[model samples]
Target chain A: SQELEQSPQSLIVQEGKNLTINCTSSKTLYGLYWYKQKYGEGLIFLMMLQKGGEEKSHEKITAKLDEKKQQSSLHITASQPSHAGIYLCGADRSASKIIFGSGTRLSIRP
Target chain B: GAGVSQSPSNKVTEKGKDVELRCDPISGHTALYWYRQRLGQGLEFLIYFQGNSAPDKSGLPSDRFSAERTGESVSTLTIQRTQQEDSAVYLCASSPVGTDTQYFGPGTRLTVL
Candidate 1:
């Protein structure tokens, strides 16, 4: 089984400040996905990184896959209250399976 | 296009009872997946169905949990003899063929007392 460890179980950031969340994997991540979820709601896909050293951004959120493909980071610039949510990282493994990390709860303060 | 939909947004069941959750995938999606998310935890894969291929049940916690998907459409996840530990948010997702992106449904929250 593939194991993914996410750092900073919870984060509190001030509005307009930048923040970063990290997801690390013990095995190679063929595909890494970033998602946001409000408590008791469904997950919203943010981005997916496949190739090593690849980076993708959407609005103020940016995700990058490391050259080794074992780590991925999500950076949010000029964070706002709307950016507060639980950030989760998922890895697509063999046999078409996807495993997710425990998730990081992000709270943005005004 | 309409996103994935799930029925019985929240279900409260007694111990040893049976609960069934339904999911309707987006039109033309060939792959569907089921996952469970416990409070303060991440999503745990339950099962997966891709087209007409055999479903993968490796992630299922026990035999009391079973799921079925019909052709590329609706899916039902049945939990027999529900236990308190079974309480969680059951999520369903679907993706297009050859695409790794998964679109999720609002999820069915099951509370077994």
Candidate 2:
């Protein structure tokens, strides 16, 4: 089984709408990270949540990690066309490399 | 001087051939990693090199995939007897010691026919 799983493989929302993407892990997450990738390009680090119950925000994008450290969510408020990209969540365990989810492709239509 | 860089931005090879992809990490970075992303699939960890030693090769899918780094500068991933399944975008990333953020390269898109 995949160590990390993402919900709603693809999503389309009109501009100015709010959306949320979920990430779940089969095991406890020691460190969770969010990255955004445009088509045909490399990934751009968004934020890192290492502690449980931690929350961080960048512009209109907000990320929250649950207290259990088993799940994390990325929320975008008033989505913009620039927000259209593949959202990937990854988790790193003790002394283990990062494992990424299949990714959620989001499209914000103007 | 800027960020990670990879060479031969794209490659097209036939079956049963050999291919080498290169990666140049940021200056002074000590950790380098290689990953592969197939179409519609998530990134798959292949290998990691910290300084002159690689503590983990567990992610390598097979013996056909091997990577080596000199000091902490440039690294190369070589795949032999390439199969169609090997086609994907290979990405390289580097990070400062103990830092969780990884800076990525443009990636080399490999297409096997």
Candidate 3:
């Protein structure tokens, strides 16, 4: 079985501070995806990284997959209250099947 | 619809009763998936349908849990003789053909008493 472990289960940071969340996989990752979700809502897609050293950025949020394909990270720059949510990392477990990580709860203290 | 949608946003049923949850995928999407998220837990894959391919039931927890998707459109998840431990938020998602980036629905919260 594949396990994608996420670090810092919960975080609280000042409004202007920057933060990073990490997701480590037990095996090689073919595809890594980042998603954000507010409580009681559907997940919002952030970015998808498929190759080693691949990095994608949207707005102030950026995601990168390590060259070893064993880990991925999501970095939020100059966070604000609007960035508060649960950040989840997903990976392809098999053909047509994607599994999610435990998720990281982020709170931007204003 | 513009995005994935699920019916019966909330359901409360007896332990021995059966229940069905529905999911409507986005238009033109050929991949649909079902997942379960228990309280304070991550999403767990349940099943998946890709176009006309054989549906993947590898993630289903038990025999009592079954799901069916009509073509590439809507899907229904049925649970028979539900148990108290069956309570959770069932999520549905859909993606474009040949893509793994899925758009999820709001999910159906099921409660067994």
Would you list the C-alpha lDDT of every candidate in the order shown? 0.85, 0.83, 0.84
Estimate the overall C-alpha local distance difference test score of candidate 1.
0.85
**lDDT tens digits by residue: candidate 2, A18-95:** 999999997888778888866433466788888899999999999999999999999999999999988989765433
Candidate 3's residue-wise lDDT over A55-109, tens digit each? 9999999999999999999999999999998898987665434567878889899
Model 1: docking quality category: incorrect
Per-residue error for B10 in candidate 2, Å, reads: 0.3
State which candidate, 1 or 2, has the greater lDDT.
Answer: 1
How many pairs in model 1 have backbone atoms within 3 A of each other, for residues 3 or more apart or on separate chains, i.e. clashes? 0
TM-score of 3: 0.55
Which portions of model 1 miss their true places by more than 4 Å? A1-110
For candidate 1 chain A, the 10 contiguous residues with the lowest summed lDDT are A91-100
Runs of candidate 3 exceeding 4 Å displacement: A1-110
Q: Give the proportion of true interface contacts each model preserves, from 0 to 1.
A: 0.00, 0.00, 0.00
lDDT of 1 by residue, A1-110 (tens): 32889978899999999999999998998878888866433466688888999999999999999999999999999999999888989876542244677788899999
| Local error of candidate 3 at residue B85 (angstroms) | 0.6
Q: What is the DockQ of candidate 3?
A: 0.05
Instruction: Encode model 2's per-residue lDDT on B1-109: one tens digit a residue.
Output: 6989998788999999999999999998888888886754456778777776644677789999999899988999999999999998888888777543467777888
Model 3 residue B2 lDDT?
77
* Clash pairs (backbone) in predicted model 1: none
